[model samples]
Target: MSHPPGLDLGQLRSHLDRERPGLVGGPLSGRLIEGGRSNLTYEISDGTSKWVVRRPPLGHVLATAHDMKREHRVIAGLHPTAVPVPEPLLLCEDEKVLGAPFYVMEFVEGTPYRTAAELAPLGAERTRAAVLGLVDTLVDLHAVDPAEVGLGDFGRPEGFLDRQLRRWGKQLDASRNRELAGIDALQSALGRSLPASPAPTIVHGDYRLDNVLIRQDETDGVDRIQAILDWEMSTLGDPLTDLGLLVMYSARLELPDSPISTTASAAGHPAPAELVERYAARSGRDVSAVSWYTAFAWFKLAVILEGIHYRYTLGQTVGAGFDRIGELVPVFIEHGLTTLKDPKNSQNSQNSQNSSEG
Candidate 1:
């Protein structure tokens, strides 16, 4: 199982042939998808059906962090649940197959909106409905009983929040170059503002607009969420963290600066606040505490993006996105600071208390 300098197309096709046998009709066609920072994703087709293959990045990665087995198990467990996840097909732990561990799944075809502008063509009514649909999906995901879904063992239930904060904090420290005063300040603020945990729910680790897939059948009129992609970070944890991460990542560009613009409706996307209200109404979960979640989301995103920054500095990245991501760290830090300034908002205050006790 020698790791190739990059993806081996010939070997991949041979493996597919051996694995699926008569299912594939012809020789596979490979098209590499851009923008995945931590994994290699390939779109493969046999002239009839399309499938996706995901494997680890070319170099070193955290042990157990990108386990294809865990990802396959999680998606497979959630198949019968309401969460719209891709149908996983095969998982190969034998490193000899593709140089590193990889898994294959049904190729889902749909537009993944990276910004609000892309969501705009849906018009105000459909846009609002679509946002609500996203919330509904999250609610449905959280509502499923882990035991029934066979995901009760996703991760340790106790101390999930504390461990998350500590984990991200460590990640930030390890990836920081030097003299990042704001990074230090953000770490302190996050540590001090820790919220009590909510009843543990399935956390999507990276719940945001871009991670979702939408089916826009005009006849059906955008009725179903096609799939929720990238389950590498899925776990059992504080669900509010997922909500917070969404708000943080999709923060409106007017009052607060977010990496992905919420006003992207010109491009066709819903605003962040609208998305939040939709989620609150659908989930029946208190939305008042959303601010804290937003702040925490910023902290977590900053940490994650900084890891990309570290890689870019090491000359490991091949795309343009990672080149500028390091510059966004301060924007997230500022958002975190703004959130803490008004932490006493009645809605979020109650949530904080509830979470601390949970």
Candidate 2:
């Protein structure tokens, strides 16, 4: 059987046999999982045993993005926690095995709702329960003490917000091709008003509805988040960054046929403010600076989309929907700028002042 690009089934089977003998029960067949624009994820099976694999994109990979080892590390660390993550089976750093570093984990059976239409079938009540579960899982993740989980050295949290702004700024610069109006303004404004981060925790850098796998509980017939996938950006930092990214996605894109994924427009999906309030009440972290973090999430996503667009231009990206990714960058930049300057976020200025002083 023909496997997807960036993965050689024969080599993979050979490696699995060597590392975990008898792990492969039959011939291995695989296909690339769609809807992932950053890393290439594959679902492989040996006729009986199934597994999921993750690797970097085809080409033009950014420097600090798509670290398979780091992804595996965080998942392994969190597997035992209340936060749901796939059980990491093995991590392979030998580049020759797959031409790039990759890892394998147990295949999680669930649906990653990518659009409003996909979520509409669950009915408003079920959808509401599932989305609220996303918030609760996030709180559970942030509640874990990183040191106790052996992830204390996972990231540098002291200057996290500043570093994140600078990191994504550099990422945007790296993907620069066309002139992105207001991107510079957005980046500069984020730098000018960094919020004081609360006590650091393990953050799912790209937390959203689609990034998680939701399975219906047979006992209750209620949809529940089975596993939180896509940990390529997981790190130790401001946990609110995760909430901000979640909130940004919770708002409707409003663009026709936008390539960005969101379930916010779905029936019973929680509002951005409601998600923020739930997180604050559960995590007990001051969310007063959420606007700044939300703006930063917008900036971060714009850079990410631009990077995907850049790779698409170079014929390095895999899968459909990439041709339209370039159109979303400008919209994200505008959102970031507007979120920063929104009068409702005037409290963010005081938060920034307090953070800078602290």
Candidate 2 lDDT by residue in tens digits, 273-337: 76788898998999988989989888988998999999999998667689999999888888888
Model 1, 235-280: lDDT tens digits are 9887878877775654443433334344333322344565577777
- As for model 1, its CA RMSD to the true structure in angstroms is 6.0
Number of the top candidate by TM-score? Answer: 2
Stretch of 10 with least lDDT, candidate 1 = 346-355
> Candidate 1 overall Cα lDDT vs. reference?
0.71
**Cα shift from native, residue 150, model 1 (Å):** 1.0
In model 2, the clashing pairs are: none
